[model samples]
Target: MAQSVHFSTPVDTVVSRMRALDTALPERDGLAVFNRVYLTVTEEFDRQLDAGLFPDRRAAISLDVRFAERYLTVAEDGRAPACWRPLLQFRRHPGVRPLQFALSGINAHIGHDLALALVDTCRTLGCEPADLEDEFDRVGDLLVSLEERVREELMPGPDLFQIADPLTHLLGSWSLERAREATWAAARALWALRGLPDLAEEFADRLDSAVGLAGRMLLTPLPI
Candidate 1:
């Protein structure tokens, strides 16, 4: 089962909950594939924290836990945002490859959930988005490196690398760089609109819808 455990707000507990999900899910399950990648990334983030990479350790911990909670919420209850719906909906489809699943989940988490997480962390820590920029950049750097590794490890080989290949275009169509840029912008906008709860929620809903469209494209069925 891909169902997750009871997760607490603490960082270690977050990691442990993800680990439990990883252990319970089947190896080839799409949810498991993404969960495994997320587990590795979260563990790496935890290590960097322990090593004191962030200048404001407290801020970093707050952001990390809040960011993780966005995904864990869905993992625990299937109460996913629009951006996450595509991956959850198509996860079991035979035509959706492992790499597709991985990327779709990444697209949803990075593009949509991240912005909300930033806002959430700021609210919890009584800080502004500007205050958390350094920690955000550090985590972004880690994500960039890990994304490259994920592509290398999960991407299909030369046999699937032709101009005519749908996967080629699909892979090229989305860029992590662009996504991060947009996420940061969204976070700032969200922060600015915090005073107007209605507008802020509308903005978030639109962002979620936009990211969901991208995720749906990423999960487009491929030939089995």
Candidate 2:
């Protein structure tokens, strides 16, 4: 029997899980690096919710919780998608920069899991993606803002050593804006393919694999 989708997951539960990871994981650990960045974003969302920033509080919370659950499940279960495999495999390597780990994780979560989460939210709410567009855009804006903060916080200090570094170039190659645009398109495409389960699965799998390949490249251990 197909499991029923429920939209009642409390925001506190997911926030607590993130807080626990923040306390347990080392600051420089790849998962920790990503977790810190993500945790900040989640916290901000929660504050926004309290402020009544969302027009549909239930939908916002549902989307937010569902989006987070995907990452938490992968982290705890070790059943990560291909896009997340590189970060998991290379997380502890001394050669990988903190920014690389952070961005790679973001790449995987936003690139693949985000689209699926959108679909998950839709099913739970008995609504279409169009119905949740406002929440999606608001969340996307928050992500973009957090990405800026993450870059600023993780970027190496200015110096010739930092300016000429490969990490700088590698980080420069990817853009959160482009990723967000792609994710929106993917989410809409997946929703369109809702009736064609096999095709949708194939599309999602291809997306997962492709994002994973990019993550692997991003995590290439640098001599610096």
Candidate 3:
């Protein structure tokens, strides 16, 4: 047999898949750029989970895997909802910076996939969205740190940048903290609407379109 691999957990499985992508894609490839960032996040989640950082480990694992699977699905098939199209479609454009790709992917994943993942986790665990609040907050804290790094490393330095810069406005406009809060609210709303499949689908569709719009804006090619 050419392959015989076993994952210790679902997190491990995703981590491995991400590692594979990281290795397979070109260094400058847009998905590769985002893949590296996401891999770091997933690894941190796994480490924190192992260290008992999350109170409900099972719920955390479920949510983390569910959320990641959404992105992986798009990555695997090259077919995704509107929310993911901007990043995947513009991935190879030279004008789109690595930071843009990274943030765009995060925007789609957190703004759209994450909310649905929360509802998925709630149903899988036979619980409600409130039960996963701790995990949600914990992950949000991680994304906040990621956002901070994106700015520090990607934004222009004080010597070169002005207050009226478009890039400055773009970076400032996107906030993971606000996105997390909105996703939490969305998850609650989605869980409530689960009983009404038609309405829920419509709501989800609108959300997908809105997130795609945000993602497309984030990916606006710059002269940088």
TM-score for each of the candidates: 0.92, 0.93, 0.92
List model 3 lDDT by residue over 1-224, tens digit each: 66544337799999999999898888988778888888988999988887777888888899999999999998877879999998888989987777788889899999999999999999999999998899888888888897788667766667656532767677667888888988999999999999999999999999999999999999888775
lDDT of 1 by residue, 28-68 (tens): 88888899889888888887776667789889888888888
Number of the top lDDT candidate: 2
What lDDT would each prediction earn against the true structure?
A: 0.86, 0.88, 0.87
- Model 3, which residues run further than 4 Å from truth? 1-7, 156-164
| Candidates by TM-score, descending order | 2, 1, 3
Clashing pairs in 2: 83-212
The TM-score that candidate 3 achieves is 0.92
Cα displacement (angstroms), candidate 2, residue 24, comes to: 1.7
Question: How far is each candidate from the true structure, as Cα RMSD in Å?
Answer: 5.8, 6.3, 4.7
Q: Candidate 2, TM-score vs. the true structure?
A: 0.93
lDDT per residue for candidate 2 within 108-202, as digits (tens), equals 99988889999999999999999999998999899888888878877778674754377788888898789888998999999999999999999
